[model samples]
Target chain A: MIALEVKKMKKNFGGVKAVDGLSLKFEKGQITSLIGPNGAGKSTMVNLMTAMYPPDAGKMIVHGVTLEKWKSYNMPTYGVTRTFQDVRLFEQMSVLDNVLVVLTERGVFRSLFETHGELHLKQAEEILKRVDLWKKRDEKAEDLSYGQRKLLEIGRAVAMDADIYFFDEPFAGLFKEMVKTVVSILHELKNNGKTILLIEHNMDLIRELSDHVIVVDAGKFFAEGEASDVLARKDVVEAYLGE
Target chain B: MDYIMHLSVLVGVYAILGLSLNLVVGYSGLLSLAHAAFYGVGAYGSAILMKDFGFSFLSAVVLSVLITMAVGVLIGLVLSKFDGDYYALASLGFSVIAFGVFLNWRDLTNGAFGIFGIPKPEIFGYKFLAGEPYAFLVLLAVIFTFLICYFVVNSSFGRVLKAIREDEKALQVFGYKTTLYKLAVFVISAGLAGFAGTLYGSYISFIDPGGFDDLVSVNLIVVVILGGLASLNGSLLGAAFFVLLPELLRFVGMPDSITGQMRQMIYGLGLIALMMYRPQGILGKFRL
Candidate 1:
């Protein structure tokens, strides 16, 4: 089932076509890797779909809701969440608080009176333990190492429990252990039927993890197919190799 | 004892102001200089209603807070459109505008001469004239304000505010309306500041536009930053330090002719030294 459908999404930044009339389908319960050259509009496409940037002319169908323009604040309500490429964690909050903030009730009035309940703490602890951040839960997020910051961000996204997840370079700068932790988390999320859209440049990991792959070059759709088949395409090699 | 009570009342008033400003500047990461504007609104609102309409002190305070909240929402909406330095500039503009109104509107605020014969606070037929009794009233106000601040900064709402402070765009991706949270804090913080303003005006039994000037607003920000951002206890400590430091200068035995100037110099040097040594502030986990 298509969890997200982008129809002719177009975005331009001052004569540079960041995402130009590109339409694609992201399937439910599957991991889809969106690969592209530097400045190939992969991140732009994610921004457009998540409503971070206004599409020059495009629309998206998310969670059965037809949106002519993507609205960033509406993403979570529609069961969609994304992690930033530059790790954006609540720097002053405790590591536990970083995840707990996302897990707490979203309602304004309810949140005002409600403390982090036992269930919320349990959920936060479970996610933190999964990311191996439970021990550092009392430390500030800024005190974490670069790799740990990335893990905490993923942990935050996990706590959101959104049906659709967008991971932007989650494995970048991570150590092998951290990478394995993230990969396992991604697999676990996929097994639970959460749709994952990853923007990554690691060709080997892309081929290994993505069930399907969407490739873009210079803001245009270059290729789309099963992961291995698309990676083997002559055009895909030339696009990456700059031949 | 009388002198200590007088100093305590002043410290309590500034503490309320510090904690209130800390909410907007520290937790929400909004540099709002217009807090003094709301503070002025409360002072003038209660003064006008009580003096002209014969309203009770408590009713006047409640009405003034409501008035400040309304004004805060309007200004907050406009300020929310901008971030970082721009937000600060826009809020400062509002503060200036509020000050201008207080200064120019002679009929309501008595203009430059200021409101005279402002009524003293009375509850249940007992008048809080002065001395320890009045100081206790101010202390009660401080306690009430602190409790409210504690409950808010500890809740999920506060967690979101801190999240908003960290990265509003990231919070937006999580489906939180960052603007609404910012605006809510603006209104809440402003209303609390206004409450403090009411207490200040009644305590002094006089008020003028000069008291709510940009310097006072800057001092409020200094309290938050000096004690620490995002720390309620820091607000109290900051306020005490700011209020008491000047008084301590009185004991330095400097000549009365240059005592004020010497005190200002010492205060400036001390702040610079503290910032150079501990940039995060005395107990701050965050910096503005």
Candidate 2:
């Protein structure tokens, strides 16, 4: 079944159309990759999906309701979670606190006086262990190596229990081992029937990891279908690999 | 001997001030320019109550703290909508309004003539009035408040605040409503600032609108930044310097005319230099 459907989505910055009549379906339990050249509006699409930016005209159905109609805090209702192009972790907080932050139950007044419960702490510990960051959990997030910070953020997302995971350039700047850590996590996620939409420039990774692919060039979908076929297209190659 | 006692009490007062401001400015990364307003609120809230209602010191102090904090929460709700220098401006507006209250609320606040004769705090059978005995009480309260801050900053709740400071969006992705956290921190900080004001009022037995000006707010900022943002120990050191430096001006042999202006200039200059030399502050090893 379609887990997320974008119907005639359009976003504009002043006169510039960042997302122009974009329409796509993300299925539950499939790994989908949105690939495009630089400035191809990949990040903009992610932002629109996350409700960070509202489309000028569009409808997004997440888990059956139009996400646009829901409040900003309920974006997670779509079971969606995402990361930034640049890693954003609480700088002064210990690495463990990063994941623990996500694990805490949030409400307006209750969470303020509420401390992290045992379950939350357990969940954070479990995720950190998976990311191999349990050892460094006491260290500040900013003190981590580039690779570890990315892993920590990924761990935080993992603890969020989002059904539809939007990973924005999850493998960017990661070392080979860290990339494997991420890939393995994705594999585990897909095996458990979690929907994932990945934004990536690495064609090789897209071909290997994605079950489906869509190519956008200059704010419009230039190509779609099997990753192998799309990567071989003249337009896709021309946009990324150059003439 | 009296000067030494005053120095310690002053240190205790500003230390509480610095710590309260630290909750917002340091940990939460909110540049609050209206802290002095809340500080004023606490002072005036108690002042008016004690002066007109003839309330005892204990009741007046409690009422003042609550009233100031209530005002603080309202301002926090509004300030929560803004950040960076914009948040600063919002706080600045609150400070200005508080000043207006101090000036225009004539019958209650004595119309800028100020509130005097604020009785010493009477708790149980013990009394905290002038002299070393009162200084000890201030010291105890300051220690208690600072300990609370230290614990809060080290707790998971405080980490969430720091996270919001680092990247508000990051907190959202992890499924947090950062606006709520920011407002919570603001209210807490404001309440502590009000508590400081209550102590100030009871100690000095006098207060007026002039004390809660924008410059006072700036001075608190100077203290935090100098101590270093997000560092509790650094804030204490900064508070000590801020409260005692004016007293030290006597030793420096500067003329009385230049004393106030020169001390303020030094505070401003010192903050700038610290931000330049060690943007992290004296003990802030982490960058937010």
Candidate 3:
């Protein structure tokens, strides 16, 4: 079953076509990877799907709902969450606070004086432990090591418990153990029947974790399919592996 | 002795003012220039309720806080659509409009003549008259407001505000509605400013339009950023600087005319220095 459907999508920055009439489908509970040469519309598609930038002309269907039906909520409201290529956390805030912020209920009708209940603290603790950041919970996010900051942001999104997860180059700067930890998390989330979008350059990690693959050049979908089948294509092979 | 009493009350009032503004600019990362308007609203709101409606002092302050919060909600609705420089300008416009209303609406606000003869608050048979007792009253209110803001900004909600400040887009992708959080923090910050306004009106025994110029707004920011942007204790330090500057001027035999302008210049110079050297202010913990 298709979890995400993109059709006739186009995105242009001034005169540059970052995503040119791209179309693709993501299957339910599948780990999809987007791989291509530099300047591919891979991240643009992810941003569009996440509703960061309004689509120039396209239709995106998520969970059997068309673009019209999905118009009610932006990226955040659609139960979609992501991590940036550059790790961004509330630097002055503690590592625990970074994840804890996600657990907050964004309800404004509630009085300003109302406090966060015990459940929020519990969830924050669980996510921090998952990222092995519980020990450094009190430390400022800025004070964390490079890899730890990445893990902290990942922890925040994972703790967010969104329906669709987008990891934009999650493995770019990770150490081996940290990479292993994230790889295991991807499998765990996939095992639990979640949709995952992996935007990465590490072919090994992509092959290991992605159930499906997508290739974009410029702003258009070049190809997409089962992870093995797509990666086997000559064009994808040439563009990525340069064989 | 009389000057010291008045000074103490002003310090306490500015302390509350600084703390209220802190909730917006410090925690929520909003550059709100309309805090003094809400501060004015609070002062005038409580004054009207007590003098016209014949409500008790406590009830009047309570009503004023609620009314200011309602106004905050309205501003939040407009402000929720804006961010960065536009947000600051919009808030400043609000302050300007409110001051205009206070000046023109003579029947309600007595125009520039303003509301006078506001009686001291007497709660539960304890009178908060002028001098030491009143200073004590204002101090307690300032302390209470400080503690409340401190506690909230340290809580989970406060953390989310920081998140919104740091990375609104990242938070949005994380399924957190950044707009709602922004509005929530705005209303909270404005409400606290209104609370300070109530104290200001009672402490001064009067309310007027000129008292709420943009300079007052600038003064509030002066304290918050000078003391430290996000430190809970920074508000107090800011309040001290604002309240003590004039008295310190008296010691140096500076004339009143030059003292006021000199103080303003000092504030400007201090802000520039802080932004250049220590953007985080004194505490240097939460850099905006």
Q: Could you say which candidate leads in lDDT? A: 1
Docking class of 1: high
User: How many residue pairs clash in all the candidates, one count each?
Assistant: 0, 0, 4
1 against 3, candidate with superior lDDT: 1
Global local distance difference test of model 2: 0.82
Ten residues in sequence with the least summed lDDT for candidate 1 chain B: B259-268
- DockQ of all models, two decimals each: 0.82, 0.54, 0.49
For model 2, report DockQ.
Answer: 0.54
Q: How accurate locally is residue B142 in candidate 1, as Cα lDDT from 0 to 100?
A: 94
TM-score order, best first, reads 1, 2, 3
Tens digits of lDDT, candidate 3, B176-240? 56677787777877788888888878878888899887778878888999998877788888888
- Candidate 3: stretches off by over 4 Å: A69-79, A109-119
Give the fraction of true interface contacts kept by model 1.
0.89
Once fitted onto the true fold, the runs of candidate 1 whose alpha carbons sit more than 4 angstroms away are: A241-243, B256-264
